[model samples]
Target: MAGLAVGAVVVLALLVLLRRRYVVARVWGHSMSPTFHDGERVVATRRRHYRVGDVIVFRPRSRTTDVAWRIKRIAAVAGDPVPAWLETDHPVVPAGRVVVVGDNTGHSEDSRQLGYIDLAAVAGAVPHRAAPEGS
Candidate 1:
């Protein structure tokens, strides 16, 4: 019983640390193709803010899907206005919004397709790709 208690405590500590540090997500769709493939797993850090060029996942505001977990490069941050082609009426990204774009424009459906994502929608920033076994 004593050993069990200690083991439980250790496991809880690890879970807390891991949750505060990183999150793992499986890649879906081809929005970020060539950079992150479908079915691949990626590790993202739960950091405060991401810099330009950082790959991130956030929710999309489109009718096709309620929640879109897309990997896109941070093009601009809050207070910055997105390009004209992306949208026409949406104001500059708010103080808590992030402008993300796909690395591959040809196939990616991102800010260009929808709009800026609120910082609250950001799940995390990808730190590294986890390759599947035998590949």
Candidate 2:
């Protein structure tokens, strides 16, 4: 009886925590390949400070029918210069925006084609897969 009661309590706690703090999403494409594989599952926090080099899951700020969360690496913060390799006319990332890119740049569509993502559109930073709840 005690074991069952403890199990119920633990399940309740997990249900509440999953509802409030994290999102479990399955990766769907190769846009973020080499780092995150297609069909791999990821757990991301609801909100937090994100830094350059962090791989994040976010929806595009621009209008698009695609609703899937895209995973990409933050290449530059709000004020950093866009890399010359991007071949974009905009020299630097504008205020309140960040430039994200895929590891497979040649085959991926990211900030270079989609434009700087809105700071608010950042859904969350994906913590290491080994520790889903630690973040």
Candidate 3:
């Protein structure tokens, strides 16, 4: 009986660790279509460094949408030249900031609309697709 209790406690601790190191969110818009579709579930691994072309989940500073969180692809990172299409005053992305955009640019409300995202606002990077449904 004591062994069973210890095993349960061990499992609980691991679960808590995993939760702190990862984020699971559901895609809600066509902004990332062709890559992540609406209604799809995705998992992101928490990390400190993110680079261009990496997909990430973040909390938007703007309240343009009702959703609590958003997913986008990194277009540029700190020290990189800002994309000309985005009308920012800075010639290059400032430190501790990143520019993100939707895969489907026409339908995305991304860096073009929200400006540079603070690294602190990011939840994590989508390292891979979510596990198969119902697994």
Candidate 4:
């Protein structure tokens, strides 16, 4: 019994550490429709790298946005050539910045209007294979 209790404690501690590195966010709008819907929950893990097509949660620091957190798919990353769809001065995505867009282009307020999102603003990236809570 004592051995089982000790193992449980160790597992609990590991979960706590993992929780700190991962964040759960609920989709709030139609931006990610078809992939994620409003009220669906996703788990995102904070890591040193992110790639195009990976959906991520971030806080928009620009004056145009008021939402505390926004979910969008990465379109470009550092060293990648800028997508022709974007109107920006830089030919390549600058270091430490990324271009993000909504899967549903018509409803997303993304890098198209907001410009490059600072990597520091990114909370985490949701794996493409993870199933959302509400389906």
Query: What RMSD, rounded to one decimal, does every model reach?
Result: 5.4, 6.4, 5.4, 5.0
Ranking by TM-score: 3, 4, 1, 2
Best by lDDT: 3
**Residue 135 displacement in candidate 2 (angstroms):** 25
Report lDDT (CA) for all predictions.
0.72, 0.76, 0.88, 0.87
* Candidate 4 structure quality by residue, lDDT tens digits, 51-119: 887889988886554567889989899999999999988889999999998877888889998889999
Evaluated with TM-score, which candidate comes out highest?
3
Task: Write the number of the candidate with greater lDDT, choosing between 1 and 3.
Answer: 3
Give the CA lDDT, 0 to 100, for residue 27 in model 3.
94
**Candidate 2: Cα lDDT at 55:** 78
- TM-score quality measure for candidate 2: 0.72
Clash totals, every prediction: 0, 0, 0, 0
User: TM-scores across all candidates?
Assistant: 0.78, 0.72, 0.87, 0.80
Residues 35-120 of candidate 1 have per-residue lDDT tens digits of 78888888778778777667887666654863346677787887777666676576676678777776557777777766777777
Angstrom error of the Cα, residue 33, model 2: value is 1.7
* lDDT tens readout by residue for model 3, 1-135: 999999999999999999989999889989888788999988988998998888999999977768878999898999999999889889999999999988888888999989999999999999754322321
Model 3 per-residue lDDT at 92: 97
User: If both were scored by TM-score, which would come out higher, candidate 1 or candidate 3?
Assistant: 3
